[model samples]
Target: MRISRLVILGGFLTALLPVALLAVGYTLKTRALMLDTTLEQNELFSKEAALYIDKVLVDHRNVLQFTAQALGADALDPAQASPVLARLRAAFPLFDRILVAPPSGVTAFAVPELADNGQRVAGANISDRAYFQTVLRTNTAYIDPDVLLGRTSGAPVTIIAAPVPGPNGGVSAVLVGTIDLDSLTQLIGRLHLGASGHAVAVTREGVTVAHPNARLVQQRFNFSGTPVWQYLRGADQGRIASYVDEENTTRFAAFATVPATGWKLWLSQQHADVDAEFYQLLASSSLWPLGALVVGILLSVLLARMIARPIETLHATARDIAAGDLDRRAPEEGPQELVSLAVAINAMAQTLQALVVKERGVRAQIESAVTEYGRFAERVADGDFSAQVMVDNAGDLERLGHALNAMSRSLGLLVSEIKLATAQLGSATAEILAATSQQAAATTEEAAAVRQMAASVHELRQAGESVSRRTQAVLDMAQKTEVVAETGLHSVEETIRSAEQGRQRLETLAERVMGFSERTHEIAEINAAVAELAEKSNLLAVNAGIEAAKAGEAGRGFAVVATEVKELAEQSKAATAQVRRIIADIQRSAQAAVIAAEQYAKASDAGVSTSRQSGTSISTLAARVTEASQAARQNLVAAEQQQAGIEQIALAVDNIEASSAQTVSATAQVEQSARSLHDLAQTLDDIIGRVSVRPGAERRVS
Candidate 1:
């Protein structure tokens, strides 16, 4: 069962058991005490009944004594005797008759009723009866046996006798009082001790005197035959007897002896009557104890349930705690101990709930930190180092984030430095490339200038070649002119020799000339033709001079040619003159011919020297031009090399620029990562600040 049920049941049982035991104990004790009390009450009732009966008997004896003393008076008159008898009968109702017996054995003067009937016998010696005999013998009052007497009428009676002494100290008469047994029996019948309880008067000899039943009165009671009589006879005087009666009915009997009458008074009660009050009392007492026991048990159960309710709630909370519901709590209301337990349990639950919440928060913080770290790592791996995370106020997490941020910042700074270096290197390389390009342009210009110089030198060499060829042609023309002059001189000399031979032939031919003079006239005509030719030559010379003047400087060389022709003609004329003279001076003209030939030879020599000098100058000019062309080719090769070197440097600068760009990209990524880390540190600080901890909260980590 659940703890609550168990606790409640245990408490109920605990409260109920002792109360039930006490109630049962009380019931049992009460029953025993009530039984004893019932018996005692019955005994007391029996004693009261005995005393009532004894009082009646004593009253009867006092009447008898007073009557005896009245009868003993000394007046002794017949007139008084009748009045006294009437007075005695009226005074004592228990008396059947009041009779005076004289000492001389004479009856008293009888009443008229006894005289008319003659019922009285005087001096009859009646002392044989116990009351009469005792009164006469002892001079005291006496009680009679049970008898039937006829005074007014015959009835069973008990007689009381007392001695009347005569005036001189002698007995005068006896006064007898008779009591009706039937009347006593009626009184006994009216006396009620209890339901089924009766009063009885018995003689000392066990004869029934007065009884509730008239038939039993004045009868000899067989003491051994009836249980009530036997119990009364065996019982001590003034003691009660409890036994079954002759009717087989249970009874309580009490017996007392009357001192004056020598009679026994008994009060008899049925046991059912004596025990009736006890039965009702027992029922009430029994019910009281039982009701008390039931009420005690019910109250115990209710009280137990009330006490256990808080504990039960506490136990349920404990179960919830075991099931991992750390927030469960119990109401702290109950008995002192149970309330304390509930309070403690609630405190524990609150503590546990706080702990669980703290643990979960810590775990969440750790996971967040781990996730941020992972993101940082991913950014780094992707070369996007500029990513950063904000840190909250999360104590240790904040510190760790700050540390990561610092590291990232350092890395970013390093990347920035490298990027700066890369940019600087790129800029320097670009400047170098620009300078190299300028150098290449200058070299190209130098090469172009050298090429122009080479072309100029080649043109100069061609010009030199042309000049040499033109000089050679001039020398050849001069030589041809000298040869022509020599030929003209030879023709003149031959004409002179022919003239000398003709003169000899003319002497021979003077006759031939006279004959020839006729022929000479023909010949002279021929001579005249020759002379005309001479005249024509002179005209030609004159014409040549005029033409030279018309030609001016341009016709001078032509005029000289014309002059040479005229000279040849003139030489012919001169030859004619020389022929005329040669006839006479042939011998002298030989020397003159030799001198002209010498002058012509000298002029040829000078022409040869001038041609040689021109050839030498032309060769020197060709050599100088060939050297200048070689220098221009060398300059072209150097310019081509410089241009190639400049291009190579430009390509290297481009590569450096590309490297610088990549470095800048990397530096940007590093900056981004540093910023991200710084943000993460700030987030961690904020989280730490927001978290609440109780006073005296212990730190699990630094």
Candidate 2:
């Protein structure tokens, strides 16, 4: 931009400053108003929510009072009170159970004969319960500090007890109804504020009674330590407060006390929720000013350009002159000052043009001399020492050409000398390069051989270690084998003796079984004899009975005795047959036992023979293992010796490698020096030979 445009823009900005300030001031004022508006809105919400919760509590309390009034004097009668309690429990769905407790601390009647937790409570004592004690003393409604959860299907519930007044104006009995906190939590949970914000209710003692999170309700969160709670502790009216919550989030909260239960209701919102409107307002207001500023800047630039138009013409002319158009002049036009400036610039241009004309002639002469000198120099630069300069008519230029001619002649002679030196230097460098290359090749081969030797040494060391480990392992095995072999020999001898003893025992067992077999055969023969005797007694009895019949009464007594003896004889004969069969089975078993005993004796003899062979084989193996172990130990000793020799050889090779490294380093330095000398000689020859001395003539020194 032009300077004039910048000045105009600056003035425009200065004029618009107050408007920008007013916009900023308005934004700040709106922000404050927004904050106050948010706080009032939060406070209003808190009051409304508190009233809602209070109304529910009042309605439930009214039901309890009405029930207590309806109970009359029959509240003490178990039979009458039971029906009344059941009716109340049915009528109020929120109550988990209802109970009528007398001043004596005994609950004579209950709705379902069970407490909220499913414990029998009709005859249970309610004197120790918090709700019962509170209602008994206060003669008013008692809200249970903690809601105990039911064991069966019901949600957690608190006892709301209202005392029944007696005719004497003293409390007679308390009517307790379990209020399910689920309804209260639903009430609070349904109250959603701005996105994710919500409300919570804590008891008079700061224990959380209702919350969105069941865990928090179960936790009975104590709100006394929180800033919002502390603020509400000192005031009955709902008010908004700013604080960080337990989750470390900045929040704007309003709190109010539940007048019926003394519980506090906190309605909270995140800070961002409250600031949303303020930022939206600021954004909407800020766009207009930004657009206006852009328009103002554009207008300023156009106006400034119109005012500075004449000055731009002179600027163009000055640029043309600087670009080598010295004849270009600014037109003397536009405003008076701009016209004067153009006139002055034109005058300067006219004088500069004349001077430029004179300078052109001088420049031409100088350029001609410089051109001829450059031609001679170019010839010399290309390694041609035959070109010379033509003297010019200009006085100083002619002298310069003479000097160039003399210098070219001198340089030609010098180039001849330098060329010969460079040729010798090149030959020396070639020889040095070849010698260094051959040495490097030899060094490389030696390094490779040394690396191989080192690798072999490493392998030998590893092999020696492996051999030592194996030999040690073999030696241990051989010693163990020898011990085992000696143990086996003793074991084999014991085995042989035991086998002989077992064979003798088996032979004795065979003889006993053979004797048992013979005994069974003899028993069979004895039973056969008894069978014949009994048959004879039976025949005698039968004949005696026939005689009795012939002799009438006299023979009858004798026949009877004979009949008895016959019967006993018959039984004895039958027993004898059974004993014979048993004897036959015993004989078969005895024969089988004898066969098994004989087989056992034969097996014992074979076992003894096998044990003897195993001992002999073990003894041979022990001897062979000892010999091998000895050989391995000798080889191990030799390998260790070889490893030491190889290590010494490796050390000698390392020395040779170090010497080769030093030789290579020295050769590299010599090669580099030779190369530098060769390059320097070539450069000097080129410098001298390339200068113009004379054309079509060659000069050589050697």
Candidate 3:
């Protein structure tokens, strides 16, 4: 069993045992006391009965004394005696008979019914009894012994006797008063004390005089022979005791002696009847302690249970707590101390539960933060800088996430810058390569132009040799023709004067044509410079395209602008080719015209030689012929003017050569500008690369 069960049981036993013992002790004591009380009540009732019988005897003695004195009086005559007997009988009804006896042997006895016959010599022998004899001899009143006797009426009687005085004063008549014993017997029968309790009257000699039982009255009682008689004689005047009678019935008896008549009055009661009442009292008292003991046991059990229940609950709760169930709680109830304990225990349980939950939550957060940080670190290690970590709940973990995100963004920007720089570098290199190719093409064209100039000089030498051969043959023929023409010289003199005017007009026309050729070469040089500038702009546009690609999405519009520039460069190249072709056609035409002018000059020289020979042959006619020869010289002069015009055209060709040299210098400057643009693009590429962006999988340049 548990400790609580033991305690409760112990408490119940402790409470019940003493109360049970007390009840038993009380029951025994009460029964004994009730028995004592009943015995005392029976003794008191017997004493009261004895006292009543004694009072009746004293009243009879007083009546007898008065009658005796009346009999002794001198005034007592026979006639007076008869009246006196009448009065004495009327006054003392307890008396059976009354008589007056004189010394003359006359008797005067009064009977209540026989009053008519007065004094008579009657043989009522009470005059010879001891009490009657004593009265006559002693001259005193006396009571007679109980005797059997016949009065003057022949009735037996027990009587009282007194001596009446004589006229001489010795003895008069013997007075005898006879008592009725039957009447006393009837009075004793009427006395009642209690149930089974009765009164008895006995003479001083132990003779039964009067008793409630009719058979016992007027009987002789042997005082020395019977137990009750012996007890009454030895016992005190008023004494009480319990005894078993001859019939074997237990009785409580009391005895009293009447002083006036020397009679004993005894009262007796049954002991069993008196003790019945005490038993009832004992029964009633017994129930009280029994009820008290039962109630005490019940209260002890209730109190014990109340204290133990909470302790048991606390024990169970403790066990559960030990087993790791923090949620269990004990109920708060019962006594002050118990309730307080329960409250404290429940508080402890709740606190433990809260602590467990808080610990779990903290642990979960720590693990989550560790896992998230690990993933972020993994991404960073792989060079995938685009991943970002998000922070929540604003703690150390959140701060760490923010830091990682910032690093990622910085790395992304760095990688972008590096790609831009690489692209710019590639564009610059392409520009430099294009510029070097154009320079090589220009050098090859210059070499071909120099070879063409050598071929033109060789052709001019061959034309000079053909002119010398023709001059010799013409000289011989001119001598023969000179003789024949001498006569016609005078008529030709008028024509020579007209030819000199034409020579001056032709010189003016040649100067104007040479000025137009110089102007055209200057215009060709301006157009060539413009073409080179357009080509340089196209190279700049290509560099811009590289920069736009490097800038990625941010430079898309700039790339479009670069494309338009490239188209403009192509249009400028076409216009430059057209200008170069026009310059070449002009050079070819000018060379052809120079060749025709040389041929015409040779023919005119031949004509002038022939005419001069003819003019030398005639003298008087020579004057008139001089006039004719002058006309011929005028025509030769006009031809010489045309040759001067051709010489002016060759000067214009030399000026065109000077303009071409200037155009070549301007093209070289344009090529230099394109190379500078390429170098600037390369610088931009370096700057963009140096500025870090987010790193990609590799550090490769585009």
Candidate 4:
């Protein structure tokens, strides 16, 4: 926690932090690049594998198509077809069998003699087979969607069917070659993927065409619902995806479609395996940063010691100075900043030592001056004015000694003067006492007269206060009334505004209603036109019915239509009459409502006029009351001023009476003090004779 340690820590972090961060960033970036490269490589490999598989399938299809083409019209004849089929099967041992089926979809010939169940494949009905049906329909080469169990070998195989052309140019028979799927399984198994990596081929339907696990191939395992199938099914070209397999192991896989067979080829590697290899490379690259961190720690310790050495030296010097060793000075050395600090500390110590010495000299001077001053004070207390303070070279103390010597001389003269003044004061006091007694009697008589006048003024002051209170009450009432009148005026104005708004709204409503009535009348006119049309239509229908009756059986439909038209016309006329009656009723109601609104508007106008008059009258009353209040307030102010003047006079009279009483008592005291003063002056003169102002001097009072 010391600054040195903190600085060392800061330096260490500065050296190590960036290197550590670079190492971490490099590791993470390398891992991302490595993973990306791995995924790309897997995708490329999958595409290559898919192409290889497609080539293999194409080779088989080519042989089947060549045989079918060569057979021409002889494909239906076992004599010519059997030789070619046997040759094709022998040349490619990957095929389980070579068979030929006629257009009837029945297998007419087969290279293999017997099936795995001992049934003859030649006689078997091939009509129900999907590949035979496809060949018969499109007349093109087709590969089966899934691997099937071979009828001859009882092994998983896929069929490739090619059409045989008839003599007339239509497909006459199908040449089918069954290829064993084990060759594809072995081909993918031999792929040089890393440990825990393998290639797979699945049918478009998600059935396993070829897999490293032979059991899955034999069982025709379905991957239709698996994540691997979901990725493969949608991929038109090579792409990489990650998924967890049925074994719960996460894997990165690349999928590509085999163009020839529409099967998907997947090249996959386990995630854990890839990560392990990546981390091994990362660990090997991390040692440089580790070494850097160790070197940083060593350098930081060296730097900390360099920084702390000079500071420690300064610290020791300061400690000694605090313990009273003022002679010690800090050594000025090391960095410039430390050197400056040491110089400042040494200067502070020197200045403190000099101040201590100067303070001691001053203290000694003060002690000597105080001793001399104490002796002089004793001589003065004994009434000896002949001695003087003689201490020197003491600031303030020397000035004090001089002042004491002058005060002793002045005191000797002051005592003689005080004795003479005391006798004169006694004589003057007796005359002053007689004069003060006469003046006090006259002041007492004047105070009585002033007091009597104050009482009468006080009565008038009370009456003035009563009038002031009444005026203030009237003023307050007038202000309140004025406020109330203003409130009423505002209310009246608001009412008038509301009534005007109501009247305007009513006029708008009446205008709208009148417009509605005019619209209704227009509707009536339209209804009358409709009624006239209905009557004309009815007349035309009746005439048409009459003509139909004359025309006989051919006009029966026309007659029936005419009767229906006549009935519709009659009903329309009745409906128009009812609409006209409703419109008339609405018009009447609207007119009555308009009259009522007009009447209410007039009544509102009358009420508003009355409220306006009342507001005006109240305002006038408030103004008159305010004027009366103002006049009364003026009278009250004048009375209050007179009252204040009288009260001041009363206070002055009371003070005069108290002063006169004190003067009379003081005169009697002065008469007794005069006699005491004469005795005290004689005693002071006798005491002054005992003190030696000038060495054995004596005084005599005459």
Candidate 5:
């Protein structure tokens, strides 16, 4: 709460801020750099180790491939491949054994032959081995991940095989070489990564190929479940990672992969070991800022005391002066700025003492002058401007006495002028009131006229709308009539076509009737000829009968013949008479049919003529109706236009009515204002009459 504490606190903060910031920034940057360097060094070591391993594996693969190519088809034969296989085994000591297997996966030849279960290694059937099958199937080189123990040496070994091509471009045999994994383990173990650091190599399946612990390699230990494998799995070339190991110790690991064999390598170190130096540097760096803070606090307290002491002395002096002790003064002895403030405070106290003495003298003069001015103000308030003040001293009171006299004279003159102006104002306002009353009456009449006109225009618009509606109905009816007329014309056309077709058919019927008449006549002629033949035969038979009588019994036979012929003649004559009658009936019916057909043709012709005439009349009626509809439509359009014009007129009239109404209202307000002005003029005359002015300052009353 005190100035001394605030000063001390402010100074301390200013001095310590930079030191604290510098310490923190340096600690963070240093830690980051050291962490990066540690990780980078571990990663670099893994890469170098991986490259070394890759080179060893590649060299072995190349040698095996070269030997396989050199042996070619001969690799399938034990006698032919023995010498070359011996040289391959002697050159690469890392290989425990070198052998050649035929397509059947049986070993045909092997260097340094060893017996397996009392059978020579040469005759061993390895067809079932996955590595042998892989070589045979892929027809390329392969490195097996399964570790095998040497039969004789009892050491970890793995197989790397290359296919030997035959003369037919097929694999004649597989050239397999066994690698001593102990050698790989020793090579990785040589890396000098700290006390807790070690490197190991594993296959893609996490099967250990080389490890510092030889027992793990011999047992084919799998690291797939460990945190180290989590970082190594599927890692392409190299990376840095950290995790808690199986031993419960957090470790930083760098992973690298051998490109030649797909084997993963990692160099692991304890977390504490990697960051040991970084922590030590951070601890030592914090000490300097802590000591700087302590020194800042001490210096701030001493400096704050020097500044606060002078200000505290000036505070006490100012308090005494405020309490009416004008003699008190601040000391002018500390810093230059403090001394200046002290002198200003002391000068203010002296000025206060001088103003107090002068204030007493001025107070008495103001009181004496106020008493004299009061009497004059009282007379003015009572409507009497007849008296004035007369002070002795020629100061503010003397000026006040002269001002009162002037105001009294001026009030007399002003009252006289107001009386004269009030009378004229009353007359002018009366005239204005009369004129405003007349204008209000005229505006009221105009408003009523405009309203009536607007009603008339609105009625006209309604009538026009009615006409438009009726015209639309007429047009609809006309459209229906036109459709009917068109249908009637089409019917007339069909009737005329039917009439023409009927006439042609009637003519054909008449020709058929004539042909029937001619046929009947031919039948009559044939019957006549038949009748004549019958009559002649009857005559012949009768003559024959006469001659029969002359010849007795022979004549009887002739008479029988004649009688039979006579009977045939009578039947034939009867048939002839029936044929003539039927012919005559047919002729009469044909003539009747011909006459009926001619009558029907004439009737159809008349019916068709009547239909055409009716259609013509209907068409003419439709045209007249359409014309009437168009005229009605034109009238409707004209009426609609007139309606719109009337509507506009109605709107204009409405607006005029409103304007006239507003004019009347404004006129009434003006009339009221004029009356108020007249009444005010009379009130002014009375008010001015109450005040007494000097003699001879009078005006005529209205």
Candidate 6:
């Protein structure tokens, strides 16, 4: 059930159940009491009707006995009884006749003259009459049943009979006064029966003696088998009973037995009529309770609203909160306890809202910090580490920012150290490579000198065996010339190859340096792009901060986020600056290396040309030694001239030796520089390795 309906029903039950029970009990009690009172009233009416009939009979009998007494036994005959009877009948108009009957069972005299059944009363026989028989048996005045017919009128009458006195003190005749049946009916009709209420009289034989309806008077109203009859049969008077009458209407009746005639007088009323007053009283009394129920229902509705409205408000507010609208709150407008409950709910909502806002702020800050740190990491991967995370006044994030700033400073210092060491190492490696080229050239020159000295010795040995006397000087000169030429050829020809190879290697190195410079330029361009992005990010953060401020308290969380974004932008700016600086250094180093390589190439070309000339001079010296062997005296003279050429070759060889020696010395110095460069490179590698930098593949989250 909905809360409103449930509350209404509950309130109604609480207020109405007991009242309903009490109303039922009152109705039952009132019904019983009213019925009892009605029955009593009916019985009283019956008794009053019985008393009226008895009085009329007693009065009639008294009058007849008095008149008979006035007449005496001396005046009982027709002549003496006539005037007395006339006066008696005149005094009581209800009487149909006044008869004087004897033991002969004949009526001797009757007032209004003769009143026998269409017969003269002077000699009328009444011996068989019940009243006459009753008088003779009882020797007293008696009232007969109203069912007996009058002699003259032939109508039912009450027979009031009494024995006439005898001077001998024995009964001689009976005096009878027949009262009209209508008199009894009129007497009974005078009873206190309201509208729809009536009285009826029945004889002991079940014959209707008197009724308010004349037609029912002499008719057979057989109440014998009924509750009225059963109760009144043994009752002398005032009997009460209930039964369904001839009309199929349930009735309550009371009966009283007439003492004079053994007849029962009944007063009957319909059950509905009997209860009319009770029903009126019942209807009137219900207003109070009905009014109370109406008032209760109204109050119950109000109470139901009081209880349910707050709960409904709370429920609605909770739904809104769950849906992420944390601003709604319950009302505090119900009962005291309910108001307190509403207050509690509102407090809970506010607390939860605050916590949620705080959580959102924290989450945004963390996410912004993570993304900014990721960009910072990217720069660090590209060997730029001069950036620093900006700190804020926020508790945890401020502390985190401080830690990050410290780490960035430390990394920047470490990278600076590494870059300086690498630069020095690169310079040393370049010198070492140059010196190795020069030393290789000098080794070739020495190896060629050893070959030349061996060839010259073989030639001199040939001269000593053939032109032993004149070829001595020629042999000496030839050996010197071959030695110088061979020395120069070895140094010059191999140096040509060494210089070319060195030149090629230097060209390669310069090209590689240029490539590295290009890469640096790319890195610089990337950094410039990052710097531009950071500037845009900074502007966005500023706009966000402004919006957050406009949003007031609701935007506190966003304010934090904006601050974090701005800090990230600043960090990017610092990193981009660092990258640009490093790129400039790389460009300068590449240009210097290119200049050194071009100078080395020119020197290598000069060394190759000088070596070709030395090879030609050695060939000429070999030809002159052959001449000295053919013409021994002419060969001696040509050998002297070859000596001059040998001197010139020696001078050229000496110049080549000096150049080679300088190259070798330079090579040795280059080797030391290379060793130093290798050590510096190892230091740079160790330094770079000290802080592990995962490439872009490693994504960072808060």
lDDT of each: 0.60, 0.76, 0.62, 0.79, 0.81, 0.74
lDDT of 5 at 583: 85
- Candidate 6 TM-score to native: 0.47
Candidate 5 has its poorest 10 consecutive residues by lDDT at 693-702
Off by over 4 Å in 2: 1-32, 41-253, 258-324, 330-359, 371-579, 632-702
Q: Residue 500 of model 2: what lDDT?
A: 94
Please give, for residues 522-575, the per-residue lDDT of candidate 1 as tens digits.
433454467669778778887988989898998898788778777777766655
What's the lDDT for candidate 1? Answer: 0.60
Name every residue pair that clashes in candidate 5. Answer: 548-555
Query: Model 3, stretches more than 4 Å misplaced?
Result: 1-52, 73-83, 100-108, 113-122, 137-139, 143-158, 186-191, 221-224, 279-702
Give the backbone clash total of model 4.
Answer: 0
RMSD of each: 79.3, 11.8, 72.9, 19.4, 15.4, 59.7
Model 3 lDDT tens row, 371-399? 76787777766667777765655667667
- lDDT tens digits, residue span 1-702, model 4: 876898789878987889978977887888778777877888898888889878877888887888898998999788887888888888888777888888887688788868777778886667788888888889888878677776546788889899998888789889998877887788788876667988888888889988888888888888887866667666666555578775677888778888877888888888776778888987887787888888888888888899988888899999999999999999889999999999999999999999999999989866766676776777778878766655344567656766876798798788667767766765666666566566656656765666676667667667767766776777677667767877877887788788888888988888898898899889999999999999999999999999999999999999999999999999989989998899889989988988887887788778778877877786787677677667767766776676677667657755765665566566556655655665565666567656555652322111
TM-score list, all predictions: 0.39, 0.49, 0.37, 0.50, 0.54, 0.47
lDDT score at residue 74, model 4, on the 0-100 scale: 90
Give a tens-digit lDDT track for model 6, residues 144-255: 7747765556777767877887888667788887777777778777775556788888888777777776776665466676655666677776645577765567777877
Highest TM-score: give the candidate number. 5
Q: What is candidate 2's lDDT per residue for 582-692, written digit by digit as tens?
A: 998888898888889888888988998898898788778778877877877787787778778877876777677677667667766776776776677677667555544
What TM-score does candidate 4 reach? 0.50
